[model samples]
Target: MFRTALRTVLAHKARLLMTVLAVMLGVAFVSGTLVFTDTLGNAFNKQSAKSYKDVAVSVTTYYSDDDGADGKKQEPGLSPKVLDEIGAVDGVASVTPRVDGFAGVADPDGKLIGNGWSNTGTNFAPGENGKDPAYDFTEGTGPTEAGQVALDKDTASRGEYKVGGPVRVATNGPVKEYTLSGIFTTEDGAVNAGGSLVLFEPSVAQKLFLKPGYFQMANVTATPGASDTKIRGEIESLVPRDAEVQTGKQLADQQAADIERELSGINQMLLAFAAIALFVGIFLISNTFTMLVAQRTKELALLRAVGASRRQVKRSVMAEALIVGLVASTIGFVLGVGLAVGLRSAMGQFGAKVPAGPLMITPVAVAAAFGVGVVITLIAAWLPARRAAKIPPVAAMSSVHAVATMKSLVLRNSIGAVLTLIGAAGIIAGASMGKDGKFSIGAGAFFSLVGIIVLIPLLSRPIIALVQPLLNRLYGVAGKLAGQNAVRNPRRTGATASALAIGLTLVTGLTTVGVTLGTAIDKATTDNIKADYMITMAGGVGGLDESAVKALEKAPGVSAVSPQRASYLVIDGKDSSASAVTPGDIEQLLTLKTETGSLDSLSGDAIAV
Candidate 1:
């Protein structure tokens, strides 16, 4: 049986190649999406482990409300008192209150520099050596004074800043001169999320950050063998309800989950395209099987005449399909792994942190790929295989075109005309519906489309019918042959048209929806952002001091500007954000749909209407 299957596939090299290509593409897509998701998950896990050491509890201030008019609670800076409260909790060993601020690091020459990018001053606990795990000291020592700084090895290497070298740094504050004390690298040092760290003592950090009595975050370390559950409860009791408390492991898991949810839709879209490719492959295989059976008609009859049961003959053809499916799947799986690796490398260049883990080929992925191959093969070969088994010895010598007589135009007319009319009605009705009616009305429209797809075989006869008269008038030899080709196999013509129609349906739907959605977002952005131009502080999502806003106001735009204050806004368990602006600036940039009060008159009231 194995030799017979091999011979059969080898006999038709072109058909086998086409089938393998299609299966390879589908498997590659599945492999890429799975690997991409796994990569992100592993990267986050490894990064979190290397960046933080045993951080059991953290409490940080966040915005309580979203009223942009009030700037009171907008800028979320952790106060030192909050740190003291957390440290006072039972089971707490020591509290290291850190004031983190990001600034672009320039070499002494001040040409190329590091962009100051930080994670909005999220807290990290002290490591085993009473230092933050995020920054590794490679040069002189950690920051001990206001003007001294520590630099990551990557940033220091890139800019040629070495130990004891005087480096000038620019931030919202004065352009301070600091000696590069040390260079360090984290375990996952591919990216410096905390930016080029010019760390300072807590007092210096407070002064540089422009927070008089506040700290950005505090890293809490519990006593050895302390119960985290009890420590968490005691910490929560000290901090306000609005403050965020999360363990290191919990944050890492949440980050991974967040990335997965974002990529879920993208994977679905890729799967849809892969399915289309597989669908097309099914047609090609079916055509190949049909031709093979047609040529083997006499051979099948001989087998039957030689006392071979119909069941035995059917099994042989099916066993051949099984063999092809298995071999193709194995080859496709190997190709898919290579494709996934290429895709991951390309994405990495664009700064996507893929998880560094071996490709996890789950049993489900293997099962799905093999199952798809088997199912497509079985369905494609079913009709031809059945016909081969049913061929009688006397009918073995029938003419090649004998099957054509059994198909007629009468049956097509009865079903074709009705479906065409119904499809036309659906398209018309669907087009008539307004925006509000589109959802409900579109369902009926989709049903109509289904009808059109089903009746393409019948409806296509009309196109053939039209082509015949035109062809008969247009040419003598070619036209007659073309007309005969169209009219001879109504089912085959319809099947081909239906397949094309499915592909176009997906294409047209996606294009239309993409354009419509893009237009909608553009309109929304235009309507909401009423400013002629925006003048933001140097750091908007990151903390920006007043000096940065002053520089923006001096820019050539020469327009009035607004200062923005933002904080983490956890509304109903979803992390949305809120920004604070002056009431007058809010009136200019944002079009307020007020429920109670005017935007111009917003004052001490918590609710901005």
Candidate 2:
């Protein structure tokens, strides 16, 4: 049976190849997307894991009340008592604490450098934090005193500093001098990238930052042989309400989960695209199967007449489909791995860090691809199978290319058309109800697209008739034959057109949405930004102070300078930012358009106007 199937496929080698390629492409897309998803997910996990190693808990403090109830102007970090309590736990191994402070370091000659910090008062200190207190110096010893500092490799190398070299260090309070004592690097090298280093003692950082008794984190390491789960449970129970405890693995998982959640919508869109490709492939497969079965109907009928039962005939055809599907799916899976690599690389260009590795192809993926291929084949071969099974030997012997004549259903067809029209009318009526009802532009557009797809077949005859004259004029013989060919099998023609139209409709609708949204935003921004010269800060909101505005006014390009203040406000639990301009002479500076009243008469209540 397998040999027979192979022979049959070989006989129509070209057609078989085309069908197989179609199936392969669809399967490849599915495989590639799956691989990309897993690869990116793992990469993110690895990066996050490197950052949060051996850290059992973290605390981030923010103002939680309406009033400044606490007289302590600067909020205290995790107290020394909290650290001691965590360290005193039976399962706890050690506690390392470090104060958070901002400081600046300069080279031996006191040259201000971008790599190191300057004039920032550090306020935090580390006391018995479980993190390794000893520094892994790249060149010299850890900080010995307040005036002694250690620089990371980046700062040390960039500044041409060595051990015992004089490096000017300053905090927010005043400039302080320090000698370079030692340099070190973190395990992941992030410390160096951040252009900072640690002072071994809490007092040193406190002096540099101009604040005392404050720390960012109390990194707690588990005792040897301690299970992370147990440690996490113990730590969570003891940690303050504002603090959060998570195992290293849990933190990595959380990061991956967050990224996955963020990209879920994008993945859904990609899957939809893959499904569309599969759909396109299904049509091609169906066309091939229809042609194949039509060509071989006589052979099938003759076999049936001799000895073959309906069951045998059905099994034989399905077996052939399975063989074809297997071959196509295998080829597709291999190609898909390659496609995944390319997709990963493309995403990397867009700033995703996907490392090279074996693709995470699971059994489920293979099963899914094979299943889809088989299902598509069966659907494609369905009509042909029915026709082959029903044809009598005499009828089959009459003509090899025989097509079943669809019995005329003028009334039934008319009824279907009427029903479709009714459905469309209902949609239109619902849309007319507006905001009071559930109708929307999106719903209307969706229904319109679907209605067009459904009614295109009924409408195709007329549409083609209108185009036939033009086609006839363009190509004398081929055009006439094409017109006849299209109308000869209305159902087949309609099916083909419908399949192609799906892709076209998607493209058209997406284009319309893109254009409409783009135009709306562009028009809105253009109308809002009526400034001749908008002087703004270099980065982020609340940029460019009043002093900067004054300086800009002193510049030669000084025209009328309008300072706009933009600030975010939360109203009714929704956040909105308002860009406020000083209300000046409304008539001189700008002309405003109003739907209800003149801008000259507008009050503060109509500021959004």
Candidate 3:
């Protein structure tokens, strides 16, 4: 049976090729996502470990209710005074206070040289050994004066900034010019995640980059022979209540875990697309197998007459699917590795600083790719295989039958109509249920699509008949013959057209929803906002400081400016956001349509809602 199945597969290679391609595409997506995530996660893990190599313990400020306007929790800076206490702890070898902030330098063409993923900043103090463990200078020395700055080697080369050359650096404070004192390389020697780093004197960094009297974090090294656990304990005892102390390994592990969590979300998103592709492939596989079984009707009946059991016939069909799936999955896995590398390069261009690392393909990824492909193909072919086994031996001598009976057609159309009504009702119910109705809507859509596909044989005849005249007029003999042939085998024509129609339906539905949603947003924005212009930071990290607001207000030709701060909050067990605006400017900057209360009633301590 297996040999016969293999021969059949080999003989129908051209027909089976389409099935192979469909499985390959889906398996490629699954394998590519797994490889990409594994590679990226490994790189981030290495970076996290290297980042904390020198620090035995870290002391940082903790935030409780510090969710910022952008819905992200803001890391509050620790008071520099806490550094003295941490340094005085027993087992603490050395304490280095670090001040970190975003800083960008322009290239010769005035293009910003850093990306959102890149961390560009200056360290406030060198390590106890009089060297910064994070950086090593490739040329000249670290910055020693307020007017001098040291840039990472990559940034220097990319921006065409040489030693002693004047460079402009932009920070939250203001843009300042400094002499390029040195070009340095970080511990990993790659732009920290595609970001740039600039070093400056402690005083200069504190004054120009960081908030006054605040440090981002303090790195504490343990004394020689001191355990990090003991050092962490000692620091924790001395550190202020607002600050949290963690061992270096704990910090590194936490960073790695965070990156993995984020990557997991991306992995799921990619796998969703893979699932859709595979779902569509199921129809193609089932349809192709059905057609193959029909073509081999006589051959299957003859085998049964020759004493082959029904089980053997079914097994043969399954064996054919198994071979196709195995071969296609193996090829897909290899193509997926290349796809992963391509995706990495594309991500890099978009400023995802994935560290250079070898592509990682795990055993689980390979197993999953093959397992999913084989399982899906076997499941899709199961019904068709059963039909092949049920073929009567007496029918082998009779003529082939291709048309459906009137009774079967009526029954199919009735079932399809009922299913379509049920599906439509479910869709309406799901839509009315709001955000929690995703599953309902998805189920509804599935049923609706299946129902529509089932009814296609009945629907296609009329649709084809209506278009037959046009097709005939357009192409004469070829068009008329094509139309007649299409209406002849309703099942085959319906199956082929349903596959394409399903994909188009989904695409059109999504596009319609997207356009409608976009238009609604535009209308809302125009109706709500009364401001002439709004200034926003490119990255929604830190908002514009008061100085920036004042500067904007003082700009010539600017009539008025308002600073609005928004923050995320848990309201009535639901995640929501609130915004703060100046009371006086609220009416001027916004068109508030009050139902019960006037906008003028809003005060510093009172909220409209």
Candidate 4:
């Protein structure tokens, strides 16, 4: 049976070409997604590990969005005294104070270096080795005074500033000029995404950021041969109640987990699209198998006449499908790995910075690709195999072509009609319920698609008849013969058209949804946004400082300014969100329409609808 199946497959390679491609393309989608996501996760993990490897323990202040008991926002910062106390601990080797802020670096032509969204600044606090652990300087040294600044390698290259040349810099405050003291490289995501990086002296950073005598956070390294747990415990006592103290290993693990969590949403979205591709491929594979079975009706009947059992014939057909699936899956997996490489390179070219790391191929990805390819192919071929097994042995010597009987056609159309009606009703009910009927809508779409595919045989006759007159007018006798051949085998006509219909419908629906959403978003933006300039941190990493707000308010040519902070809370035992904004002046920046309540008397504790 196996030899016979192999021989059959070898004889009709051209006939099975579409089936192989359908399986291969579906598997490729899944393999590509898995490979790209694996490489992404691995690169981030390696970058996090390298950044923290030298540390024994690390301390970072806990970030919060809530206000204090006094209804005033409790700003997060660490005093210099805390770093002093940590440095004096028994196992402490050194303490590095970190102060991060926003600094916009300008090109030599005096234009912003980034997209005018945000840039990053940090204090370059070098230790006894005259080097900051977080950065490696390629030229000169870390900034030493207010007049000097070190720039990241990309920033320096872009702004045309050498080690000794002046670089124009700006914060939320006034623009400042300073000589470039050094150039360095880093693994920071923001800087890699084309944001300028500015390095300042410890005191200078505090002064510019307006956080006097305090660091945003501190990192402590344990002395050689010291215990990380013991060092962490010693340092934890010196920090504030909301501050976090972690060992080096803990910090690396936490960073990796955070990255993975952020990537999960994107991975799921990619997987959903992959599944859709696989679903579409099923129709193509099944249709091809059905056509192949019909073409081989005499061959299958001859096998039965030669004493081949029904089960053996069915198994033989499946074996052919199995071989095709295995070969296609292998090719798909290889192409998927190449796709991952291309994806990473493409992202880099587009300025979405990710750490440069070797490609990662996990065992799960391999198993998943093959499993999906083989199973989907086998499922699509099952119906065709059953039909082939039912071919009569007498037909081996008969000249008449085998076709579906009147009774069978009636049965098939009845089932198709019932399913189509049910699906149409479900779609109507789901559409009426809006967002609350997501599950119903999805189920309705699935049923409708399946029903349409099944009813293709009956549906094709009417559609072909409609175009029959036009075909006769255009091509006369040849077109008339083609229509007669199509009408004679409704099953074959339906099978051939089902794949094209499924693909076309998906493309059309997606395009329509995309255009509608884009139009709605444009309308919403035009209606609400009234500000001349909207200041925002890249990726919403931080919010404006009180001093930064005051500077913007006082800057020349600025009329009105409003800053809004977003917070999530468990209000009345359910998760809800609130936006805190300045009173009344918010109207100056945005068009506000009140549904119920007024905003004129809005204060610290006031809520507006």
Candidate 5:
């Protein structure tokens, strides 16, 4: 049976090409996502290790508070006193306080010179020899005075900055001018994850980037022959209660883990699209197998007449699917490796600091691709295989094709109607239940789609009949003939059309949702937003500084500007959120509709509820 199945597959290669292509596309998606994830993870891990090469211990604040309502964690501002204490810890060799913050820089053309993932700041104390281990000077010396700054090699080249060039830097405060004192290179020469890197003098950075007496973090190096574990332990005891100490390796591992978590989301999103492609492949595979079985009915009946058992005939069909899956999956895996390489470059262009590395192909990815392809193909081919096995030996004596019976039609229509009703009920109930109703909605959609497919044979003829006149008018004789041929075999025509309809339905649903969301956004902006213009940060990392808000309030042509603060809190063991705004300006800048109390009655520490 297997040999016969192999021969049949070889003979019908042209007819089965579409099925092969469908399976290959799905498997390629699965393999490409896995490979891309593995590659990015390796790159980040390598870079993180190099970033912390010189540090033995790191001291920073430990935040017990949840991230604010903007979904960003507030950086703990460490005082200069804490840095001195960490430096005085037993076994500490050297300490480098890092003053880091976002500083927007522009090229000569006034265009931003960053990939958005760039880091900008200064090393408060560049080591004893005036060189930071994390950074090496490529063109000139490190910044040592208030008006001087250093740029990374990539940033300098891209922004057209030279050793003596004057550059403007903008933080949350007003833009300031500084001399480009030097150009430096990090360990990898591509630090900040492919983003721009700018360094300034400690005093200048503290004044412009951070508040007075505050540092982002301090890196500690253990004395020669001192154990990192011992240094970390001693540093922890000296640090304040709000701060924590970690070994260099621990910090590196944590950074790698964070990167992995972020990248995993992208991998999962790609996998979801792959699953959709595979689902569509299932319909194509099933349709192809059904037609194949019908065309080969007489051949199967003749084998039965020659004493071949029904079980043997069924096995032959399944064997064919297995071979097709194996060939398609093997080719797909190879194609996927190439796709992964391309995706890495694409991500880099989007401002991701993807390190150049070899592609990583894990055993699990290969197994999953082949396993899913084979399983789906076999499952889709099962019904058609069974139908072929049911062909009686007497069928060999007849040349006519079998047609659907009245009893089968009645049974199918009845099941379809029941399924449609149940699916509609589930959708309604799910819609009424809010955020936790995802599973119900998904299951309902699946059932509804299947039910619609089941009714296609019954609905196809009438739908085509109604559209036939229009098609004929548009294309004349050719269109009329095509329409006539489509309705001639309703079962075959419906099967093909249903496959297309399912894909179209999903696309239409997504389009409608997108359009509705867009319209709602426009309505909300028109009705709720009262300001002529709003000032916001490009990245939602840190909040706009109070100093920046005050500066803006005094600017020319500016009316009243309101600052809103939001944070998350645990209330009664459940996560809750709160937002604060000025009580006096709230009415002027916003449209508040109160059911009971007036907006004017609000005051300090007042509870609106």
Candidate 6:
């Protein structure tokens, strides 16, 4: 039966060619999404590992994103006293206290470089060995004094700033020109994020980024034969109240997880498009198989007449589908890998590059590619195979066959109508249910799409009849005959049209919704914000410092400038995220729905609000 199926496919290569193409494209899209996502994840993992090179443990101030705003006001750093206590631990060999903050540098074109928001300024605190393990100096030794700064090699090379040249560096305050004391390269994410780096003397960085004598975090190096866990435990007791101790492996894992989370949305979106393509291909595959089965009705009947079992006939048909799936999947996998590499390179060229790493092809991606491809093909061919098996020898000999009846049509249409109604109701109810309705909304959309596709065959006859008159007027006999042929095989017409129909429907629906939502959001933002322009931190890492606020307010022709500082606090013993702004801000910058308190007396906590 398998040999017969193989011969049959080989005999009419042109007939099965469309089926192969459909399956191949579906598999290719799915496999490509997996490969690209995996590659991104792998690249980030390598970067995260590199960022923590040679560090035994990382002791950091435990703070949320909002906490960083507080840092800008008055940094809650691990004090130098705590650093001394941690360094005195039994297994601790050394401790390097580091302060980090955003430090932007413009290229000759006046654009901020290095993962734009990731341009870093950090303190260079070399151990007794006169070297910081984090940075490997290539041109000169570490910067030792207030007037010296070290630049990362990549950033230095890009900006044409060499050792001993004046390198201008900026913090939130002002740009200071310093002698480029050294140039180094490092694997740290803070330095290598396609952005420039400026390493200042320890005293200088501390004075610039935070208050003097305080460190943002301390990197601890353990003695030989010391377990990281043991040292972490010992140091935990010694560190400051606000500090959190974690081993190097824990820090690496956390960083990797954070990076994966950022990539998740893109991965899911691409995978969704892949799923849609595969789903739409199902109808195309089914229609192709149905046509094949109808054309080979006589052959199938002849096999049955020759004493071949019904099961054998069905198996033969399915075997052909299986072969097509295998061939298509093999080709698809290769193409998908190529697609991933191209996508990576394209993104890099456009400046959204990830850290360079080898392309990842996990076993799961391979299994999913072949499994989804073969299973989908089998499913699409199932009904046609069953019909071919049931073909009566006598009926086929007389050139008569039964593919569907009025009863089957009624049953199919009824099922589709029920699903469509259910989906509509689910969508409406889901919308009213607020944030908890995500599952309902997603399920409703899926069911609605499937139901509509199923009902397309029933809709075809009426739609074709309406178009027939227009067609006859436009092109006379050829158009009229084409319309009649489409109406005669509604299932075939529906299958052929579904792909285009679904594509148009989805695009139109999404565009309409997106435009409407965007307009509404625009309206809301415009209404809420009375100011002409809103100022925000580049990466939302911290609130605008006083210097930043003053800089904006001092701009020519500026009317009113208000700085809104976010603070997380416990209000009446419940956690609350508050925005601290002055009475002038409430009056001039924002249009609130209601203002209960008297503007003269109203006051808010911290940061002079």
Q: What is the lDDT of residue 412 in candidate 6?
A: 84
Provide TM-scores for the models: 0.74, 0.73, 0.87, 0.87, 0.86, 0.89
User: Candidate 1 residues 26-73, lDDT tens each?
Assistant: 656665556555555556556666455666666566534454354444
Clashes of 6: 3
- lDDT of candidate 5? 0.79
Candidate 6 residues 223-317, lDDT tens each? 88889999998887876556788998899999989888977888889878878778777877888888998898889889989998989999999
lDDT of 5 at 589: 73
TM-score of 2: 0.73
Candidate 1 clash figure, as a count: 6
Q: Which candidate's lDDT is highest?
A: 4
Deviation from native of the Cα of residue 380 in model 2, angstroms: 3.0
List clashing residue pairs in candidate 6: 114-194, 114-195, 115-194
Pitting candidate 2 against candidate 5, the one with the higher TM-score is: 5
lDDT of 3 by residue, 496-538 (tens): 8877887898799889999999999999999999888887653
Q: In what order do the candidates fall by lDDT, top score first?
A: 4, 6, 3, 5, 1, 2
Q: Which residue ranges in model 6 land beyond 4 Å of their true spot? A: 50-53, 63-76, 114-117, 260-263, 424-448, 568-572, 593-609
Report the error of model 5 at residue 397, Å.
Answer: 3.9
The candidate 5 region of ten consecutive residues with least summed lDDT is 115-124
What shift in Å separates residue 389 of candidate 5 from its native position after superposition?
A: 1.6
Q: List candidate 5 stretches off by more than 4 Å.
A: 62-91, 115-119, 187-191, 209-214, 223-225, 400-409, 427-446, 468-491, 543-559, 565-588, 593-609
Over 213-298, each residue of candidate 4 has an lDDT whose tens digit, in order, gives 87877777777789999988878788876788888899899989988998888778877877877777777778778877877878
The collision pairs in model 5 are none
Better of 1 and 2 by TM-score: 1
What C-alpha lDDT does candidate 4 achieve relative to the native structure? 0.83
Deviating ranges (above 4 Å) for candidate 1 = 1-6, 49-53, 63-93, 98-130, 147-182, 187-201, 204-211, 222-224, 244-249, 387-392, 400-427, 440-445, 459-483, 508-532, 535-609
